[model samples]
Target: MLRRSRCRWVFVCILLTVLLRLAPLKSDSDPTTQLIGDVDNTQSFGVNPISLILVQKLGYQSACNSCSHRDLGFTGRVAGKWYSVWADTLWAAPGVTDPELDTPGFHGMVRSSVSLLTDDPLRVVDLNLNDDWPVPHQQPFIPFNEDWGESSRTAFGGASLCEVDAGSATAAVFILVNAFEPDLVGAGVAKVQVINGTPTVTQRFGPKGYWWDATTTPHYGDKISYRDERSDYIYIWGGPPNRYTGWLEGGYIYLVRVKAADVFDLCKYEYWWGHQQGWKPEVLTTFTTETAALWGTGQGQIVWNDYYDCYILVHLGIAGVTLYMRTAKSLEGPWTPDLEIYSTTPIDGGLVYAGVAHPYLDPSGKSLVVSFTNNNRIEVVKVWFK
Candidate 1:
């Protein structure tokens, strides 16, 4: 069953990519920003209606020549320093998938880690499994565990992070856990601790007996609250239902909120069931419907922009391969139509996906810092809103 699902998903992705190439290009009237300069011989291509600028290019090359990392899981400020979590692997090249390397028990299995960002030359610090960092062969902050499943190993490539107070004496890091095997994908929430500037997973919240699978429940954390000012609760953007057919599909983004004091109480979370009629609290329901579609693959960033008095959402179109932005006055939003920010074209023989926004990195409230994953590198760009 797992093999079949994987095969079907690959076929669907290929067919969708081809269909997108054949579709007519979307027209945009919004004013955009152009690339300021080039990096690593790669220039930004396509129109960015959101005025995104290429500020700096962060390369992942480590002192150890073989391993590399991609997939920006999440970034947050911990103990007065900026840190990012990413999915890392030991593979030497792209497009080379060895089952031995892909399996859960593989020594070089994909794992998650937190890295400190430094300024002098724009490089990563304290990178796990890298010679440049002090920590070597340190256990993954969120490693594949026995409780997940016999064959299930987890890689949180698209995870989101937020700082929340669990009413504890120490600060806590809330992560949207994305777990998957070759056949299935699931999500949940995990509590992480910063021990001496390193992230250590301490607890998890989700369904009983099984990992947070989409086929079993409608509630799974996608993006956690980045800038909700409320001290009482933390908000999470939920993803689509995980289908057995291997394609997780949904057009509307959902909202889930849990009390900041009760971050670990999975049963206490409230879903936004409100509609056009009015707002109401429900146990587990979607925040939006099909009529108000927010297109994406459920991996993106959401930040509150005080300058605009609204929430900004950045995501990648699964079919179009374009990065887009939408704004809403409220968390349960009547979101504006997607304004094309940037689109991915074939670069260095690889495709791009998962364009996310880093509002904390943007010094000017009007400028936005965006990051996207290419086949070989993670590209970061800056955008200014008109």
Candidate 2:
């Protein structure tokens, strides 16, 4: 009888061990609980629970001429307040003739500006543009001039902002400029300083061609950078080649990184060379690409989520008609297959692009505040990750 009892006790211990191994890991601050109260067991995507909720639509009441229509840009925290820059256009209004369109000396006159978002009354303060700042009525932010040649007469917009410590008295604000020109589209880098609670440009660096632009590198500047506190490095993620010209067709994602302090130096950047070898110092080196296409058009945002402990990328996919989400454990990732989070075809008949994620706006960390341009209007939505 004693031998039988001992054997039963050992079996019970084994059963408990197996049960603990099978149980899903849970944390007190798990975002899954905050975003989705209860998840459906029968739902697809295995254990990945994701959902999008349209929290609220934000609009700006601007007095600038032809500035009523705007599209989402990057947002960053500055001086204890959240600031966002957006692409402002006047062509969206009826009877507005944009002379810059198709004019040889003139490229499309789409410019950008900054705004202060206040939560108390939920209003956007259109900060008065500095004399040097680019406005549709004035000059381009990163001006495309006679030096750039006739093919490159365009302004910068759809920019992403990141604050870097240049070891100066004030933190430097870096703006990744996306330039839209005829025939050739590319990205440039610009630096701005916050003077008296306003953002102003201090330096500008390229509508510089992509690393692989010689052979028609389709999409260039969908590159998004975030300072990874854990690694003390600035992680930059770029998009795959475009189907345009069929040079390097397919939606592929690429990644690169630089020290947070060396963000201003392009030479210091390192590319994710491959899985086996890992990050390569050469920026031009070809690397292991994302297995699946993240977006049809390469314009979106990739943000690090502290709560989820994963990187979330939001982009306009499905031939530029839908907003999709993909998550990964690392920036140079074996990213999960693209999941359709929202469709924009119904929202203004598919005149949308640049779906960017703003984590600062959402405190819960479970819901992401995303903004996209629909018919020249910047539309905001909240995506809840279950």
| Model 1 C-alpha lDDT versus the unseen true structure | 0.51
The estimated TM-scores of all candidates read 0.68, 0.66
**Tens digits of per-residue lDDT for model 2, 1-386:** 99999999999999987754434435434322211112211111323335555544444233333333456666665445666666654322332333223223322334666666655222455564333213333223333345544233244543465656533323233333333433334443456667666666666554452233422332334445565646767665555432223323234445566776676666876766455556667653331222222324356777778777777777785337677777777666556667777665445464677777777766667877777766655666656666
TM-score of 1: 0.68
Residue 322, model 2: lDDT of 73
Q: What lDDT does the true structure give each of the candidates? A: 0.51, 0.52
Candidate 1 per-residue C-alpha lDDT over 103-187 given as tens digits, one digit per residue, 9 for 90 to 100: 3333443556666655422245544444323224324656656664522355553355555642332233444344444433555
Q: Tell me the TM-score of model 2.
A: 0.66
Our tally of clashes for model 1 stands at: 4
Which ranges of candidate 1 are over 4 A from the true structure? 1-67, 91-107, 119-122, 128-139, 147-152, 166-182, 206-212, 223-227, 244-249, 277-281, 285-293
